[model samples]
Target: MISWLMLAQAIALGAIGAVVAIAGIMRRPFGDWVLGAAALTFLTLVVQVVASIIAPIAGAGPTGDLLEYWTYLITAVVIPPAAVLWALIDKKGEWSTLVVGIGILACAVMVYRMHQIWFVQVA
Candidate 1:
């Protein structure tokens, strides 16, 4: 993956996570803002998915285990939607929001791992 793109994803995810976290801490219910943020975060992961597909073709192939890299990417892509679904189903309000926040934070970490696999780790 491109270095700048990876960094941007991290920052974006971090900011999204923080927002969700604060809302949860403030005892806010799952609302439009949270849903919108989660949707945006998921869209960014979709973008990352596309970038992952195209990056290798552009000769930015990963130097680490391809399986590991793909695993992280897939998990990162899945987290937001899964968390959002859980939030929608559960009526625990802030707790559900917290779950989404945590999930997004986890996705940020996974993205960093993907960066390592793509550009830092040795096969």
Candidate 2:
């Protein structure tokens, strides 16, 4: 598990969430460009998750609680797309932007936790 890389990923995700939330707060719709950025962020998250899994299998991953690590990983993997997909389906979706931001924030938190579970041993 690469601490700095994961930290950067988390920060990027958090920043995306902040941007989305700000846009939503400003009464802006979840437009195409924001969606595109969200998609790219999700892709980055996917890559990070894959690399994390492989690292453990390669005997280089975190040695903490496997259950916690996997839970965080699974949650991190699912939330973004699920939220966006649901938002996209709704006809009105007045709150879609905010929900998407919340979802992204959740993913960021999960990724950060996963990084901790993999690299920072709890005392």
List TM-score per model, in order: 0.94, 0.88
**Candidate 2 lDDT tens digits, 54-105:** 8878888566887888887777778878878877885266777877888888
**1-123 in candidate 1: lDDT tens per residue?**
888988999998998898898878777888888888888888888988898899889988889988999999998888999999999998565498888888888888899889988888877
Cα lDDT, model 2, residue 21: 76
Residue pairs with colliding backbones in model 1 are none
> Model 1 residue 73 lDDT?
91
Worst 10 residues of 2 by lDDT: 86-95
Model 2 / residue 117 / CA error / Å? 0.9
Clashing residue pairs in candidate 2 (N, C-alpha, C atoms within 3 angstroms): none
The true-structure Cα RMSD of candidate 1 reads: 1.1
Q: Which residue ranges in model 2 land beyond 4 Å of their true spot?
A: none
